[model samples]
Target: MANHHIDIHHVAKLARLKLSDSEAATYTLQLDHILDYIAALDQHDLDAAMPTAHAEAVFDVWRHDEPRPSFTNEQSLANAPKKSQGQFQMPRVVEE
Candidate 1:
């Protein structure tokens, strides 16, 4: 990867952030440093390295299914700020 500069004003606009001239200048250098680090990482050799799916090995670590005592409906709803019947009430959500 070649060294490149990020357009701080454009980035700020995309992220809906307001930055002063000094802040934009500071962030431009910081973003450039980050990109430089990524470029350096891209030059690493990994031909013989095994790909790891996760940071640590994961096996049958789940608990076996077993019945356990749980809070009753009344107990569950007792602390809710809003409740309807025996269930917690929530505000309606609108989806795009």
Candidate 2:
């Protein structure tokens, strides 16, 4: 992806950043290191590598979803800190 060098000043301007000389230098070095690492990874031999979703084998550990008994109104509101007319109450969140 990184075929060309990154222009730190151009990138800063595009991002609306007002980077000082020191900041630009630091970012340039960091970007160069990242691109160099990617270049190194590009040298790997992967012709025989198989595409996979995960590095290790994985399986579904979830349980079946089945219908169950429902809770009563009172049971559902048992732990409510504030309730009115058997319903939970909270601060108004909407505006006119």
Candidate 3:
């Protein structure tokens, strides 16, 4: 439903791209041809076709959530570059 000629120029300007005159002309023709093909497809009748949610039928594919043991504070901080009071320490992140 969109005009490809003006759309190309608009997109190029928004993206701060500079295309040669020859390149713009070439792309305009190519894009128009592609849109024409899509327009041709719009004439097909799909009124009786059933809409599909997915390409294939899905089965029970989810994994069951299970509880697992987690590392303690001391174990988690064991490999840190620096630690303080049983916790990992890092450089200040914010500046005044």
Candidate 4:
């Protein structure tokens, strides 16, 4: 795949494409047969292929940080429409 010579009208003038010299000779022979089938898959020989990031031996189970309780600041301000010294006030959303 590195013998590189693919100028389909300079790649349709860098993708602002308006190609039609028979669509740049049919996309330069369909990108030279998909780059000669990826140069025949670069002469295939993966040396017993086994370099995986994730073909699913999945992980990240995460749950055991241990802190189980419940809320109480006066039962969480009991449904505040504007609490003050214990918190939940909302209205001065940044302008300055």
Tell me the TM-score of each prediction against the true structure.
0.43, 0.37, 0.39, 0.23
* lDDT (CA) per prediction: 0.88, 0.86, 0.81, 0.81
- Give per-residue CA lDDT, model 2, range 5-47, as digits (tens): 6799998999999999999988888897788777876688978
TM-score sort, best first: 1, 3, 2, 4
- Runs in model 1 lying further than 4 Å from the true structure: 45-96
lDDT of 3 by residue, 69-93 (tens): 7898878988999989887789899
Q: Model 2 segments beyond 4 Å from truth?
A: 1-4, 44-96
User: Taking the tens digit of each residue's C-alpha lDDT, what string does model 4 give over 1-96?
Assistant: 335458888777888989878878777877887887788766988779888998888799788899978798878988998889998889899998
As for TM-score, the candidate ahead, 2 or 4, is 2
Model 3 lDDT-worst window of ten: 1-10
Worst lDDT window (10 residues) for model 4? 1-10
Model 3 alpha-carbon drift over 4 Å, by segment: 1-6, 14-17, 47-96
The model with the greater lDDT, 1 or 3, is 1
lDDT of model 1, residue 75: 96
